[model samples]
Target: MTNTQLIFKKRPIGVPDANTWSIEKNPIPEPKEGEVLIQQHYVSLDPAMRGWMNEGKSYIEPIKIDDVMRAGSIGKVIKANNHPKYKVGDCLTGWGGVQQYVATTAENWYKVDDTLAPMPMYLGTLGMPGMTAYFGILEVGKIKSGDTVLISGAAGAVGSVVGQIAKLKGCTVVGIAGGKDKCDYMINELGFDDAIDYKSENVMLALRTKCPKGIDVFFDNVGGDILDAALVHLRMHARVVICGAISQYNATTRVKGPSNYLSLLVNRATMQGMVVLDYAKDYGNAAAEMGKWLAEGKLKSKEDVYEGIENFQSTYNRLFTGEKNGKLVLKVL
Candidate 1:
């Protein structure tokens, strides 16, 4: 049978828009030794995908021209051969690319319980973004009870979860998002103490007014000026967790570095970077806790699911538009 695939055409200068990809209908390759064939149900669309399309030194290799565009996906195993512990009909998550079928080794694949959450949730809160928020906040940010936590991009997947998790930890949570609806969801729905509509008002002023004692932990997703604003309002020994820089992802020029980094010295604050893959061994335990919170209704996971891989370019670009409310996923099946 033939499988539809989105191939990386050329390295993107900024965003991976219409010119970056080409579609192909190719024969599905049979699984080799220690491999399983996946009938992918959902493909994860993350801001990190834009970074992967560029050629540079990073945590992982760049997507080469003519190769299948790399993406995370959850799917059912339609066939398996030469692999122990994996069977047909097992739902799993892996870097399956933007394709209808994937034949890959079990090394990167993890079995997911579709019963606990929907299939797409596995690619969202129950998946990488959830793990990212878990480790980035609790571990790297060093959050404690009664501390004030400020999050940028608070309505997006990782940021939304970060705010909810901070609230659950007894921290006074504040969020900065784009519009009225996003800010409303962060405050009224997600239980954040304050919400800033960056599109309407000045973020630094809003943060200063909301967090008069200063920010104890800043969980930054959208960087650039927002990161600078956080730096300006840091409390003594504040932790600045650099989880992502979505604001600078599509920059044509060099990424704008924070100008207020000197505040870190004044506050004796610590700024650290976190890569989720570093905590791979601890995912199961973290997922268990997050799952319990989800079950108990203390934590919420939201997904913005799209349909069809053929519209992959526009769907991927939608992330930068600030229109999506949660984790963005594309239904491939």
Candidate 2:
């Protein structure tokens, strides 16, 4: 049978619009020795996908021109050839490009069970977003009890979890998002103590009112001016966790530099950047911990699922538009 995929037809000079992608259909390749054929269920749509599209120096190589665009996906094995311990029906998560079917070795894929949680969660909390929030908060942010934590893009997958994780650790949480609906969801649904509508309010003033004692940990997702605002109100020894820069992803010009970095010196604070893959070797340990939290009701995972691979480009655009909430995924099945 033929399988469809999206390819990086060209290296976009700036933020990718609909014109940057091309679709193609090809026969599903037979698995070689020690490989398995997987039918993709859901594919993760992350803001980081924007970075991978550009030709530049990064922690990982940029997606090559005309290659199937790289992405993380959850799939179920439909054929297992020369591989032990995996059955034809086993669901797994891996770096399965934007395709309907994937044939790869099981070396890096993790087995997933729907009985434990929903299939999409495998791409959210139990997957990269969860790990990003987990390590970025506990390890990089170094959060403590009663600490006032502020998160930009607080309604998003990673930011949402970051706020909840900080809350679980006994801190007061404030979320900053784009609109009133997102703000309401952060404060009402996610239990964040307050939320600032960055689109409608002066951020510095909002920070002053909401985080009076100053932000103890700033879990930053949307960088740029929001970062500058958070920096000015940071507490002494505050940790700014650079999880992502969703705001600057689509800029036609060079990203604006954070102007308030000197505040780190005045407050004796530190800022740290993290890529979730840096901790891939220890993902099992972190997932296990997050799983326990999920079971205990201390942490919640939300997914923004879009159906069909045909809509990949438009669905991807949602990340930059601030229209998507939670961990965005495209349901391919």
Candidate 3:
């Protein structure tokens, strides 16, 4: 059988488009010693993928020319060789890229059970999104009960989880999203105390009205002006978790820095950035907790799935455009 792989056609100069990728078919490979052959099902489409495509200094190296486009995926084991840890028919999560099949060592992959959760959850909340929210809050943000927490990009995958988790911790959570629907989702569905539509509302004014106690924790996902707005409202000893800068990801010009950083000094607050990879050793702990929350229905994950490997590039485009409402995944199966 032939495996279809989406290869990087060229490095993107700015926002990526269809020209950045090319698809080709090749014979599927047999698993080598201690390796497994997987037939991929779902592929994660993340905003961070844009950073990984650019050549620059980062936590990880950029994807090389002509290489298979990098991604996280959930797949089923079709064949296994010399590895007792994984067997045929076992579902696993790993770097499956934008491909129909994958042949790699089983060590990097984690076994997943669809019976416990859907395949998309393995690519979403139970996967990187959950880990990102878990570690970015408790480990980086250091949230405390009764603290007023504000989150940017509140309706997206990571932001939604962050706001809900903050609420679960007994904090007054406010979310900043793009529209009334998302704001409604935050307030009515996710249990956020308040939400501000950045496109239609004054961010600082909304924060002032909602967070009468001031902001004790800021979980930032879109880190441009929204971050600046949150900075001005920080309470004493506030903790700011810099999870991502989605607003500036597609800029053709130089990325802008936060100008209101002086709030840290005035409020005696702390701002820290964290990469989810930094906590890879403890992913199991976080995943288990998130899974428990999910199983109990205390947490929910929203996924926006687009089908086909050929649609990968276009589907990724939706993330930057703010058209995607949740964890973006490409259905390769």
Candidate 4:
């Protein structure tokens, strides 16, 4: 059978756009010894993908030219051989790349139950983004009750979750989003204490006004100006969780690092980077707690799923456009 795939053709200097990848059809390969075959149903698009296109060192290896694009995907096992854990018909999530079918070991994959939530959700809130938010805030941020917390890119997948989880931890949650719609959703729908419109208002001044006592924890998804804004409001002993830097993902030039390095010394605050894979073992525990909140109507998630694997280029570009309101995913089936 023919299997469609998006091949990484060229790395972009700026936004990848449509020319960055080439889509083609190839014969589906059968599962070999110690491998499983998955007919992928959905794939996740994220800002981190842009970084993966560039050559260099990172938490993960870069996607080289002529290779299928890397992505987090969910699908059902159609074939399995010499695999102890996964069985045929079992639904799973893994690094399936951007393709219609994946044949790989079960090591990077995990079986997920459809009864828990939609399969696509595992790629979003109940998956990497959820785990990132849980560990980044509770472990790295070291959140405490009544602490003032601020988050940039507050409506996106990871940042939205960080704000909600901080609220659950008894912090006064404040969000910084692009427009009034996102700001309104953060405050009205998600129960954020307040939200700053970074597009229309001076982010630094707005953060100062919203967090008068100073920010105890800052979850930064967008770097550059937003990171600078958050640094200006850091309280003593503040902890900054570096979840992502979406603002610099599409820059043709060098990434702009935060210029407020002195804030760390002045406030005795700690700024550290976090990668979700570091807490892979604790995903079940975090997902359980998030599940309870979800069942109790406390934790909420929004997913923006686009259809057709053929539209992968446009779907992927949405991550940098701020056009997608929540976790952007693509449905291949």
Reference-based TM-score, model 3: 0.97
TM-score of each: 0.98, 0.97, 0.97, 0.97
Model 2 lDDT, full chain set: 0.90
**Predicted candidate 2 versus true structure: per-residue lDDT over 98-174, tens digit per residue:** 99998888788899887899988989999999899989999899999999999998898888999988888999999
* lDDT scores in order: 0.91, 0.90, 0.89, 0.90
Best by TM-score, which number?
1
Q: Give candidate 1's whole-model lDDT.
A: 0.91
- Highest lDDT, which number? 1
Candidate with more favorable, higher TM-score: 1 or 3? 1
* Clashes per candidate, residues 3 or more apart or on different chains: 0, 0, 0, 0
Give the Å error, residue 175, model 4.
Answer: 0.5
Candidate 1: C-alpha RMSD after superposition: 0.9
Candidate 3 residue 181 Cα shift, in angstroms, is 1.2
Clashing pairs for predicted structure model 2, backbone only = none
The TM-score that candidate 1 achieves is 0.98
For candidate 2, which ten residues in a row score worst on lDDT?
A: 10-19
The alpha-carbon deviation from the true structure for residue 148 of candidate 1, after best TM-score superposition, in angstroms, is 0.3
Q: Give the residue spans of candidate 2 off by over 4 A.
A: none
